[model samples]
Target: MSDNLKVVENATCTFCGCVCDDMNLTVDVDEHRITKAENACILGKAWFREHGIEQRPFALIDGHEATTEAGVEEAAQILARARFPMIYGLSDTTCEAQRVAVGLADMLGGTIDTTTSVCHGPSGIAFQGVGESTASLGELKNRADMIVFWGGNPAEAHPRLFSRYAVTPKGMYIPNGRKDRTIVLVDVRRTASTPAADIFVQVKPRSDFEVLWALRALVKGRKVDPSIERRTGVSLAVLEDLVARMKRCNYGAFLFGMGLTMNRGRHFNSAALLALATDLNQFTHWVAKPVRGHGNVTGADNVVSWQTGFPFGVNFSRGYPRFNPGEFTTVDVLARGDADAALIIASDPASNFPKPAIEHLKRIPVIVLDPKATLTSRLARVAFTTATYGINVTGTVYRMDDVALTLRPAFPSPYPSDEQVLTAIRDRVRVLLGGNRLPAGAAPIAPAVAAAS
Candidate 1:
């Protein structure tokens, strides 16, 4: 043990959607890195240990080093002069920064989208069609006796989810912890999570909607063909047993992942699953939630929905916020060459987007704000290195369960926070667009931005 080591207790890990906040990080102040992370999972330990101050410029303009102020000025000018600019990527950032971003979109009258458009966008659409029956992680921990994981492997993706919250933890009602719960895994094939489940239901690929539909029918006491087992790759006996367990449980929860949302049926698949959860309420308490990927992505959806009326793929070009997925989504807009400029925050779209979308992003004048140099930042005309939230900066982040937690920064960064940088850009854009005045009947910016702060 070094005499100069600093221990930060109860630090939060934003590596995944779990948002585990009970880590005790041992920081080497002289080395400017975390030496140890107590009470952290493998992923959380790696996340805390790998994050440190990088030797990169504070800002870059056209790949050249420049002052942060110059980068903000150029970014504002590029956004102001563009015909149809777009803002994307708020999933990894804080809620305060997300709100300012929505205000910036309104000020520029541009389209604003989030990573949700790709990951759980279909789930959001399904939520709108068939409202969600969700509960907090605490509720599931304490009361849920039957837990189902549909189309997601929390073992590899969210390492701490089972041991910390769902499976192995001792809760108020679940005193025996893992012994008190019945874990069911529903996926197309066997995964690491399969070994953890008491029952693993392997369905045919792309047959999630059919399986969910059959389950709903069985729950409703309606006649489902026994041949459904051949269609969905699950035996009728197995389906009946699963439904019996679900109906007889004290509390049951369905936590689905992109497997259901990004499949062939997409939103329809999610809708059917949610509708099944709704149907299960007739016999027992049941809830469903999307297992989000990013730590603050749920916060992004919440903030965007609060500021604009929509969750993602929002267009403000008509002097009001409009909700349309394919038309206004980042990938669609960029692939169609509709946007002339873009502002990306805390996301790397160039590496993951479609070829056409990546090509269009390269052609446009792009601005990025991220803690590290990412593929999107490399292609940006103006890139500002911002502080990492939940580590070097403090703000509000939402868990996958929509529980809001305040961030406690373990260390400081030389770079500015995303909220500070976005606020500066917003102020500059407002000045450029004539002193906070917006088009007739548009949402007011001052009030919304202030409320977010």
Candidate 2:
């Protein structure tokens, strides 16, 4: 142990959606790196250990090193000149940065989308169609006695979810912790998380909609033939028993994942599950929430929804905000070659998007802002190396349950934060567009401008 080490107590880990805020990080100030992360899981430890100030250029333009000022100027010019520009990837950043990005998109009259479009976009759609029954993670931890995991393997993805909040933790009502709670795992196949379940129901591939539909029927006291086992691979007896447990439990929760959203039925599958939770409230308390993947993705959704009146895949091209998923979403717009330029922040779409979207992105003038170099930054026309949130930068990030937590930086960074850089670009774009038309607090569009358009 070095005498010069600095320990930051109760620091937040932004590696995953868990956003565990009880981390104790020991920083080697001389080396500008985190040496120890106590009370962190395997993923959180790796996240804290792997991040530090890297020896990279502050900014780049056309693959050539340049000053941060030059990069911001070029990025502003590119975005201002494009007819149909797009802004994407606000998942990994802070809520402050996401708000600036949304305001920038409004200023440029460009489309703005988040990484949520690819992950839980369907869940958002379903939520809009049929409202969700959700509760805070704290409430579930202290009250829930029956927890069901659907289409998600939290053991591998969210390692601390069970130990810290859901399965093993002792609740007020569940004094016996894991013994008092009933755990149910539903998935297309058995996974690493199967071991944590008292009952694991493996369904046929792409049969989530069928299984969920049958469960809904059973919960509603409707007739469901036993032969449904042939279609979904889950016997009707098990579904009936599951429904009985859901109705009997004092508090129940459904923590679903991408397995239900990205499949064949998409939002319909999510709607069925949510509808079942609503139905279960007649007999007992039940809630459903999508197990988010990114640490700040839920923040992105909240910021965008409040700012633009939509969750993801929003467009401001009509001089006002508009919502349409397939049309304005990042992948769909890129795949269709509609966007002439792009401004990406804190995400890598090159490695994550489809072939058609990647091809179009390569052909366009793309700008990226991230703490580290990524596949998207490699092809960017302008890129800014910003300070990492929850590490070298301080801001507010939303937990998976939409609870905002203030970040405590372990150490300072040499580079600027995303909020500072985006604010500069936005100011430059406002000047280039000819006036201070849309100020920080004003509506996205001026009243007369929106009326005229």
Candidate 3:
């Protein structure tokens, strides 16, 4: 890669829901680096800052350095012999990689779950209860005259969301960006992004579901006493105004965040939003999109759903994919100490998992495959550092809207890409299975490189 020869490939930022596209890259082929980026949000810049890697590949065996091949073999042996195994963490890689991972898990009669099971499992449950109406980012950008930010701050969590697509930016039909869109903020506390909104609705913590339901009732043209106002902290008049605006808009969009899903109501909150969006469609067009946190969390859902006819929290212990969010989720399985071993790829669970799960991890052996020194890596029995996906390798990742996009590398490195590492693991797993029935296979997975190369 040279500065003069740097090519910026058109793609979406995989970091968050506002998948901003049209990013520019200045790669120096001669220098083997990404020198600059254009049109990416602040978080996107941080995502690309550690472009190429310099760390040599090695593994930890019994808390000691060893070859990655030895580690993989040891991991394979443990997983193969264990009565129950869990394969988790698929929220930061390509859909292709996620597919291969789930296939191996199914063949081994293990559980395959994603971070969503812990972060947005409730939302998924709610989705199953009441289906949602959704629109493409392009549609929202072009036609949505009213946009609401509920329980999220895109400026920090999804840095370039407003400037790239949702609130502030101009689109094909939106000649004037900020002026054309009406912005509303709903949160428990005020943040940097909320202050800039045209309307800010402050609600009590963990009362998102109650507040939303009340608003939905108001949207349906129902009258309520002041007690409803006392409960939601928003006057009935204010709720009526939001309903009126939503009904008047040609197209209305709601960009929801983890706050709704993580609070007391959990999945019901998601159900309410979906139901509310559906309700709004009775008079005017309305839709909602989850403000996802991980780069490939959406990809995990897409891959699993397409492969095994189910989404996250899929169990394969019975040699067939079974969907059960509450039982098969990573937290539930680990908390019960059902998993004897684990193979975590592309995420850091040690920092995010609950106390019980972390305690269990300390007692069990873990195999970690990632590009950085994360909390998960620190505790793993075997850790292998591979090439960074967007910088040293290229692959396909799905956007928040289920739009698949290609991520191209701008620099070169000695480390093999994620594809190579994944293919290696699959081959090793195949050898361990020896013609076992696999459920996640979509293609004849060839080895990308020698397992320990």
Candidate 4:
């Protein structure tokens, strides 16, 4: 530390899918805090306001405190004894950690996925069924003549997204960014994202799949009554107008969020969106990207797809990776009370899961590794606190579109990294599985990473 040496503030916005790269940060080294952040969103501001060191690490078991090493050892024992295991949660950590997690799932003969099953699980299904047509944010900013936000309100979820990338700011191809693009919003209610759009089509709740089907019918030239409305409350005229725009645009992109994927129809709704994107390709170029919530959820999907030849919901119980969504997913397994050990990394299922699932988690020997004290960590038999991926460590993350971007740490911490803890567990598993006196009486492992691979 020098008397007059100015600290440089550099960071990428982790608040949304846009992943805004240029934000000016001012730090107070004396207090170890951020003083000012320029060109960021409201969400970003709120996120930075709390540097969040007050969240001390704790190891709890049966609603009481336990030793950290004891917690890890107990968690390892649980995993070692189970016939079926689940290594879930990767929304808040680095892609590097995500990669390690999937690898661990492969080695453990278990399943690995995120909470996306509740959010964009449907979208992923649609993607696997009929691949999405999507583009980079840079491409949207510069070249897209039309942008349709379906089942998403980026104005609130991603505050700086429109201002910095898609609608407002200038770009290479479209100089006067927003003025050059036609923005349309489609939702059941008038939320914040509706006001900014040039056209807003209000549909009824839970009819997104039907609406998409009707739109596809129109695109394909089959006739339909203009007066008949479906569950979404959107009219044929409105659908026609939107269809026209899809035909007229030089290039377009549809950005959807949790609204489309998380409700009654779930993955079927997501599959419709994917089908609509494919239908649009018949007339012109149209793409869709799920407005994923976590900074690197897509990173989890990509890593799993590359390693296991499928995304999430993978089971290796037979010593080989096998993919199944509903049967092998986290919620179903938890509900069935089948898995003996659960490793929750960077997630809070206690808060986010259904009561049955959370109850199952409470009954089992659970291991949680996170950066903060959440309900999930509080219930874990072995809880380990690790550095925040985007805030305290540096690694790559994937936006919803599968674009890899680096996450820069704004500060440092005393906690060991997520990778360190997982690697330790991995080594412990190797020793325990070797069956040579158990390295202090731990259980044995079946196979290592090489055999699993």
Highest-scoring model, lDDT? 2
The order by descending lDDT is 2, 1, 3, 4
lDDT of 4 by residue, 37-85 (tens): 6777888876665664554754565556665666666766777666677
C-alpha root-mean-square deviation, each candidate: 3.8, 3.3, 6.5, 4.9
Q: Is candidate 2 or candidate 4 better by lDDT?
A: 2
Task: For residues 1-453, write the lDDT of model 3, one tens digit per residue.
Answer: 333666677745666655566778777777666666677777777766555565555667766877767877877777777667888987887777788888878778788998888776777788889988887788888988999999888878887777766887788877798899888889988898886589999887877888789878877877667676678777777788888999999889998888898888888988898899999999999999887778778888889888888779898876677898768888888888888988888888899888999889888888888888788888888787777766766777777787777877677777655556556767877787785544443434555688677
Residue 357 lDDT (model 4) = 94
Alpha-carbon lDDT, every model: 0.91, 0.92, 0.79, 0.76
The TM-score values for the models, in the order shown, are 0.95, 0.96, 0.92, 0.90
- Residue 219 CA error for candidate 4 (Å)? 0.9
Candidate 1 colliding pairs: none
- Arranged by TM-score, best first: 2, 1, 3, 4
What tens-digit string does per-residue lDDT give for candidate 1 at 1-453? Answer: 356789899888888899998989998876668899999888888888878888889899999999899999999999988778999999988999999999999888888999999999999999999998999999888988999999999999998889888888878999999999999999998998999999999999999999999999999999889999889899889999999999999999998999998899999999999999999999999999999998899999999998888999998886888899999999999999999999999999999999999999999999999998999999999999998898888899999998999988878888999999999999999889986435546555544646746
- What residue pairs are clashing in model 2? none
Better of 1 and 2 by lDDT: 2
Model 4 stretches with alpha carbons more than 4 Å out: 1-8, 58-70, 435-453
Candidate 2 lDDT over 1-453, as tens digits, reads 356799999999998889999999999987889999999988999999989889989899999999889999999999889888999999999999999999999888899999999988999999999998999887788999999999999998998989988999987877889998999999988898999999999999899999999998998899999889999899989998998899999999999999998899989988989998998999999999999999899999999999978999998877678899899999999999999999999999999899999999999999999999999999999999999999998999999999999999999999999999999999999889875334324455446846656
